[model samples]
Target: MNPGSEVVVTLRRATAPDARPAADVWLRSFAAALPTVVSPRSADEVRDYFRDVVVPLREIWVADAGDDGGGVVGLMVINGDELSQLYLEPDWRGRGLGDRFVELAKERSPVGLELWTFQVNKPAHRFYERHGFVAVEFTDGSGNEEREPDVRYVWEPKP
Candidate 1:
């Protein structure tokens, strides 16, 4: 295997230890992807945020690679029948790792799934729609009263 040429991204269940690294990658990518996106707390704050939000969730998964160059490249946080978080590093966005991550999460989901996104995030809204998700509800983000209006989307995997 040649080094420094390509990344080998793979999907696996996220672990407690993965929370910090995942949060780091997620914070950087999310802020970059959505500049208007509310910035994350300081690094210390983000550490606890990930631990609380992602560490205890059994349904979440992380995209990692064996290369030392490879790390937690992407992540998804699903709960009950909803996918609450889906993010990938900006550099890794077009290679379809995100799609594969979605497919894997769907496979594990016994029932249909739902997610929320700000309507202003048109790219995400379109991606979910193109992947067969339907808008099911309107909501707010993390209790932010001033946030752009948001919509909930649901996807039913082929049985």
Candidate 2:
């Protein structure tokens, strides 16, 4: 891939077969983006969660780069009004994929959407804010599995 060229990525619904790759994306992104936060679940556990829970019970989407010989580059999970997860491979960041994921989430839940990101994830704060999500609440870390302070963001379409 050239330095200035944009890689084509297709966003589509994740199937049961995508569980492993999606989970891999989540793990890599989390490790790179949130180095200070420790995940409670192991890598295998996370893959299992994706296989048994996320794929079956949530609205999951994957950014497929297979057309360009790249595998899954990103993953997003939405449940009801909550944007539960959004992760992109470390090398795939800043290419507008995250923006696309948020747009799709809004389309899926047009009324409003809510999400939580660790307070330390300033880049995420900026990204979500850019997408119209406002930080509405801050927590002291007790409510999350990672035990890291987090901030809640909400997005509602204008009237």
Against the true structure, what is every candidate's RMSD?
2.6, 1.6
What's the TM for model 1? 0.84
Score residue 7 of candidate 2 by CA lDDT.
Answer: 71
Whole-model lDDT, candidate 2? 0.95
Q: Give the per-residue lDDT of model 2 (tens digit) for 52-137.
A: 99988899999998856378999999999999999999999988899999999999999999999999999999999999999999
TM-score of 2: 0.95
Spell out the clash pairs found in candidate 2.
none
Model 1 worst lDDT run, 10 consecutive residues: 139-148
Q: For residues 64-110, what per-residue lDDT tens digits would candidate 1 score against the true structure? A: 97656468888888887878889887877878987897787677775
Candidate 2: give its CA RMSD in angstroms. Answer: 1.6
Say which candidate scores most in lDDT. Answer: 2
Model 2 ranges with Cα > 4 A deviation: 1-6
